[model samples]
Structure formats: structure tokens, C-alpha cells
Target: MRYLTGYSEAVRAQMQAIHARQGLGRLLLARYPAPHGMRTDRALHAFVTELKTEHLRRAPPIDKVLYDSKLQVVQHALGLHTAISRKQGARLKASREIRIASVFKDVPHDFLQMIVVHELAHLKERDHDRAFYQLCESMEPRYHQLELDLRLYLTHLEATGERLWSGSGSSGAHAGADPQPAAGGRL
Candidate 1:
């Protein structure tokens, strides 16, 4: 329920009913079924790059993309996008990076894509406004649904402390135990 703060009372009640019956895990597992295979930073970079190329072709180039074990879900930061500028000799160079929480390493591909799409949307729209959401939808048609499902999954995890999906690529770590932050900690 903490993860579903913005949802309506009805929705919260529905989730509560499911949790009371201990069916949140079952619902999430039925919907997601499997975790994705992009476990390493290199593979994550490739995955993000492909998504960027397909959706934000004209956006700034991304210098890095990786799963950060230090990003805690309790902090409400599932993914982060950062742009850093440094004086490179006689000129300034900017590098963009996206960091996904390591908890996502054990989630479904749709959940991963939803977070990635969110970070990728930041490349063009800096604020979570209508334009930003429109951009997200452009990239992933099921963006809103996936986001709601991800929140539900987080709610399930918070309530039961059980992971619905785990496999070879999963870190199998609890989301709240990781407390460090990436540079500039802005979600």
C-alpha cells in the first residue's frame, strides 16, 4: 500500500483484499511469469541503447547504463537519469547515464522496460508532465499499465518480503536493504 500511495481508495482496497488473501504474489507471478536475461552492465547498456535508438533517436547520447545495487526501493527511486558536465580540455562535455535498481534484475521484462522507458523519457522531457508521459507512451504503448503493475509488485514485496520471480540473472536481494545512492541521487 505504501507503494500505491497515489492510487485511489478503491484500488488500494482491492490490493488490500488481495494481500489479505495472500494472493499478491500469485497475481504478479501470473502476470509476469519470468525475469529478463540482461544481467550484466554491458548487456544492460546494450538493452538501453537499443530502446533509445528505437524511440529517442535524436536524444543525447548515453554514456552508461547499469543496475546499481545501492539504489533502494524504499527511497522511491526505481530508476535514475543523470547528466553530468565537465570541462574537457578547452570545452565542456556532458555525459548521460541511467541507473536501474538492482531489484529490477529479478523482475519481469515488462517491468524493466517500463523503468527504462521512464528514464529514457527524461532525455527529452525533464519533468513528469503530460509531455513526458506522452513520450513514454510513444515508446511503450503499455507504459501506464506496466507502471501500475510494477507498483503493485513493489506493494506485494513490501507486504510479504517475497520475490515473485527469480532466476539465473537475478540478484535475489531484498529491495529495502540497499541504502547507498548514485551520484546526484535525483530520481
Candidate 2:
């Protein structure tokens, strides 16, 4: 339905079947594994910092990074970037802040990376046109795929009233981390 609008009919049918299953939550949990616990503001700041260092080295530094519970995904966003200007003595200075949805605290690492890369790209390109997406891809090569997967994830959440990784930490298809106890596979 609402979340599947961008997908083709065939894809929607398949996903709907998945959604209609007795324990869609279990299926999703099997796929996504566990949510991450970059729960603290400091941890989030460090995480964003690493992404910036890896991809946007020449871009302006971010003054702050936070995971805000006030950010709701159904509102059509997973992250936000803001430019703030202030008066310092006689001059005006600017800084940027990035806020990710607190809901991301428990998703897979790749999804977090996608959101971080997206917000970071805004520092360079202010529009959601071709150039902005190009920049996003430059930052994360698998950007498009991860984004689609994340959308499917959101669809699952909306349909099931479930949190995919409601239990422990991230341990999924992502390579580095060891597999966690299933929310029962690796989203």
C-alpha cells in the first residue's frame, strides 16, 4: 500500500504475501537480525564523524550530530540536516547539524551508513536532483540498493506493527559483526 507505491505491481504482490504471513515479524527479524545500539549522542557523533572522514573529507565540518526521537519516519524522512547561522561578535558564522531518527539506533549498519551518507551529501549538494544523488552514490557505492532495502524495511514495519530488530544488537548480512541470536538472518 502506502509504502509500496514506488515498487512495481509484481514486487508489491510478493511483498504483500510476505506481509500476510502468520509471523511477518519473525521473517523480517530473520532477515534484519538485530538493531544497533549507537544509542548515545557521543556514539552517534563519532559514527557520523567517521563517515564524513571517509567520504566528505573536504566538506565543511558538522557541528553536531544527534539521534532525535522527535524524528518520525512516517513523516517521510529518516534523517535531517540543518544549517544554522549565528552572530559571533561582529561577524556571522555558520554550522551544520545532522539528526537521525532515533529509530535507527537498532537497524543494520548499512542502513545507518545510507542515512549518514545522505545527510552528509546535503553539505555539498542542497537539492535532491541528479547531482545530489550522484554525490550520495559517491559516498556509498551501494546507496541505491541499501535505500530500497531500507524502504522495504519501513514497509514491513508499517504493515506488521513490528520492529525488525527489536531485540539485541546488529548482527546480519553485514560482514564485520558476528551473527546475533535471531530476532529469532543477516537485512
Winning model by TM-score: 1
Question: What's the lDDT for candidate 2?
Answer: 0.70
What's each prediction's TM-score? 0.87, 0.80
lDDT of 2 by residue, 74-142 (tens): 334678899999999999899899988877887888888888888899899887767887888888887
- Per residue, candidate 1 scores C-alpha lDDT tens digits across 12-61 of 78878988999887888888888998889999899999999998899999
Off by over 4 Å in 1: 73-76, 167-187
TM-score quality measure for candidate 1: 0.87
Which lDDT value does model 1 have at 16? Answer: 84
